[model samples]
Target: MLIFTNMKWQQALKDYKLYLKIERGLSKNSIDNYSRDVDKLIKYLDENKSSNLPINITSEIIQQFIYETSKTINARSQSRLISGLRSFFDYLIFEDYRASNPLELIESPKIGRKLPDTLSEEEIDQLINAVDLSKPQGERNRAILETLYGCGLRVSELINLKLSDLFFDEGFIKVTGKGDKQRFVPIVDITQKYINIYKNEVRNHLKIQPGFEDILFLNRRGKQLTRAMIFTITKQLAEKIGLKKSISPHTFRHSFATHLLENKADLRSIQLMLGHESITTTEIYVHLDKSHLSRALKEFHPRK
Candidate 1:
């Protein structure tokens, strides 16, 4: 067992990052988010000239920091920051660096569930149709948008998608989601056709980078596309079609789930396909389409 009574903020944070990465199997983005929360507290302590270590930091100090933070950020961001700090303190306690979490008594700000925005089927069709086939990158863009909606992929998952992850005969593509969890989402034939065209015609022509040869999506220089690029593509398409509603790659994911629920797909199946760890996370789709619930009631309820 390791012990450190006088561990500095930087050292504790370094160890916490490793714990998050190795022990928790969290993605790099998640580790960075958690570390940012602790970094904020460290900054506060430095500015105030507080010499408290991880083992001796008091709830009052943390509370003061939180109060100062609330002025600048929205309630949702504040709540997430609190939750992230709470996780850090919990880790410190687990490792015996502290007797208890300083954040245990702190209450996160109450925020209502923000429903995700979705695109209608017609809107999705319009966006896809807006892609100019004459452009060199047009086929690739079409494939990317189709894959985003068809597979219900997160931006990270869509970008990290590999050529080897495709199983066309089985009609499913492997997706690596948050925490490196893998799931196979079924792909429709139309989606598959676009991917094949991009892979065979557009992608094959590019001179792929050494490390990124296996990556499914590549930019003009044959490097993996960044998250920002995906956002830009979607935004430009929306603008080109004069779409009024604000949408992103995630909007496609939300539309996928909402459309499925509207067609009477089971919550559990949707949860599995979306790679949601909890059914409650998937339950939000039910609110997106209330008519499905009413239809079920009318068809199955004995009184109805």
Candidate 2:
């Protein structure tokens, strides 16, 4: 067991961050989270009279931390902490700081998945209509909202959309997802028209910055729009419409899938449109249509 204490834990942590960034290609936020978890373990060891060393930390100590963490935090937070710790140890293993990951045997908390909040047809209309068309960027804002609801794009996917991806001739847009994987999602003519209008009228007028030539959505400065900016725009519109239900841009995506499911679009089709890797996720829509579920329930189930 080696002690990182008395030695420079901060320096080692800094180097680990570089490794995560350069070698692992992890995002800055992810690297920060991994560092934060390691910091938590180091702080805990300092208080417990144990050595603040990666090699010295035992699986028993890691399990005890989980138990203590559960006492103070909810399951979700504990789960995040467990994941953070796992990533930290994996980094250590790569750096030869630890022989094995201590977190391998620790079980994650079981969390029941909750369905996403969806907007009713009227609410969806209110949200879209809330945009004041008279203002600058109005058409663009409307198009942004429309694309989100109509296409079911993740916020990141929406922000990172490239001009090369839009294939109006084929009626589909190429989307880059988690793991840098790309998939094609069909784009309706309505969304395509508005996007084209915004692109030609507003986006083309901006001073296009270097390296952002392929980006579809650009800010007034002509650089690509950010995820935060997209959220801010949608949030203001949600408020203007007096929508009591709290929602982000992502709520539009949920509403899109839900509306389709309610309208009798096939689950397999919806799953492919949503880019879900599994049918189980698409089946959540089945629960939304309990009244229309196939037979066997009417005959066998006591509740029916």
Candidate 3:
């Protein structure tokens, strides 16, 4: 095996990041997450005074890193780290930097099927009603929350939504999901009304920046909203409404799919609307729709 330096590893990681961005078309947040796993490994190697280079590092050493990481993070995070490292080493093999991936033999920790938290219809109503509509951004915030629950948008997708994506005439909003993959989600009339109110009454009056002309959601500076801002909005609302269950912008999305499933929406339709690549990902919502499942069992089951 050819010996390499830490600098080589750093360079390889940088190139990998670029490939992820340009070739893979991954979002910045995802790129950051993938890069962070490698960063963690690098940090571990440095702190432990290990001299083994990326090209020559043994699976045993990688295992040690994983072992150390498992001590701090949960199984899910440990699994992500292992997966990330495996992807990085695979990239090295693809680039001819290494003959084989060191992480190929490493196994991920088994994690349980952790379901997401969702809000009841009444809880969602309370949260949305808690928004102070008298403020300048109140309409926009209300619209944002409504769109989140109504459209089942990821926080990133919500922030990146563009005006051109709105197709109210046909009653569907185009959403750019993970990896820049675009999908059209049907919009209800009430959701469209809220969005239109914000766009016409609030968003139109803002001094939009040069490049953000088509961006759907903007802050007071007329620039597009950040993921952090969306989290803050949801967090403040939860606090104001005294919601005990910890929730974020994602909770609204969970509620959206769960509610739909309870209303007899098919798994395939929910998957398409949520931009899930697989039905397996969308099936988790079925677990969240316990009331519907219970009612079905009681109504149809002879034993019940």
Candidate 4:
């Protein structure tokens, strides 16, 4: 390993975070996650009374930290932690601060492939219809649900949606997804109609804050809606309908992809629509409903 002296772990971590943000173009949420991984290692070092800096830290120490972490967290979380540490060490090697990565031989936990939960078409209809249109915010909530299910948007993308991003006439909305990557997703007229009603009837009347004038979804005071507020809205509706499944904003996205796949939408198209970087990510929708696979197999297979 390349030897260095007087380099502090805190300073190295700060520089690594900057590299993640600027050079790697990661989002704040992503940067925070990476930083948290480093923080855990620092905490481990402190607890063990190891004065080792980043340059001097060894694979043995890191492996010990990983071993300790695995005891308290699930396999999936352990896998993520190991992956994060690998990235950090890789960065150090790339910067020539170290000769080799500590995590080169480390492997992630072997967890089963977990499928996302999805709503049936009827269940989705029930949830949307459950919104009380008589209330002023009801139309807005309906629109939010429509966009979530229709466009397969992440919760972060939904809250960050701006008025300028909506090109209804062109039949697509510009979505800024993970890594600040922008893509256009087509919006159906029904989804458009609901959004327009909310914009014209309810959102139009609000005294919008100066900074939030272009935000599509807003609260009573016209401030941008927080992520927790969206979750609360969805949770309250689930309770109102007495739906049995534990769900979140992400459930709608999963339902969107699953439903489309069931209706014979090609995997490539779904990948594009969902803005997935890999087709493997989109392929999980296939596992959501097994009957679809059986039907496809029986219909096309020679034995059938």
| lDDT values, one for every candidate | 0.93, 0.82, 0.90, 0.91
Model 2, 178-243: lDDT tens digits are 536578999999999999988888888889999999998888778888899999998898788777
Provide TM-scores for the models.
Answer: 0.92, 0.77, 0.86, 0.92
C-alpha RMSD in Å of predicted model 3 compared with the true structure? 3.2
Tens-digit lDDT string for candidate 3 (1-304): 1124567768889999999998888889889999999999888887887777777788989988888788889899888898999999988888887898888777787888899999999999999999999998999999999999999999989999999999999999999999889999999999999999999999999999999999999999999999999999999999999999999999999999998999977789999999998899998988775788887788889999
Stretches of model 2 off by over 4 angstroms after superposition: 1-35, 52-56, 84-107, 264-271, 277-304
Please list the residue runs of candidate 3 whose C-alpha ends up more than 4 Å from where it truly belongs after superposition.
1-4, 47-51, 96-100, 290-304
lDDT by residue for model 4 (8-30), tens:
77788889999998898888999
How does candidate 4 fare on TM-score? 0.92
Error of 3 at 40 (Å): 2.5
Provide the RMSD of all predictions against the true structure, rounded to 1 decimal. Answer: 2.9, 4.5, 3.2, 2.7
Q: Name the better of 1 and 3 by TM-score.
A: 1
* Per-residue lDDT of candidate 1, residues 92-155 (tens digit): 9989988999999999989998999999999999999999999879999999999999989999
Clashes of 1: 0
Show where candidate 4 strays beyond 4 Å.
1-7, 294-304
> What ranges in model 1 sit over 4 Å off?
1-7
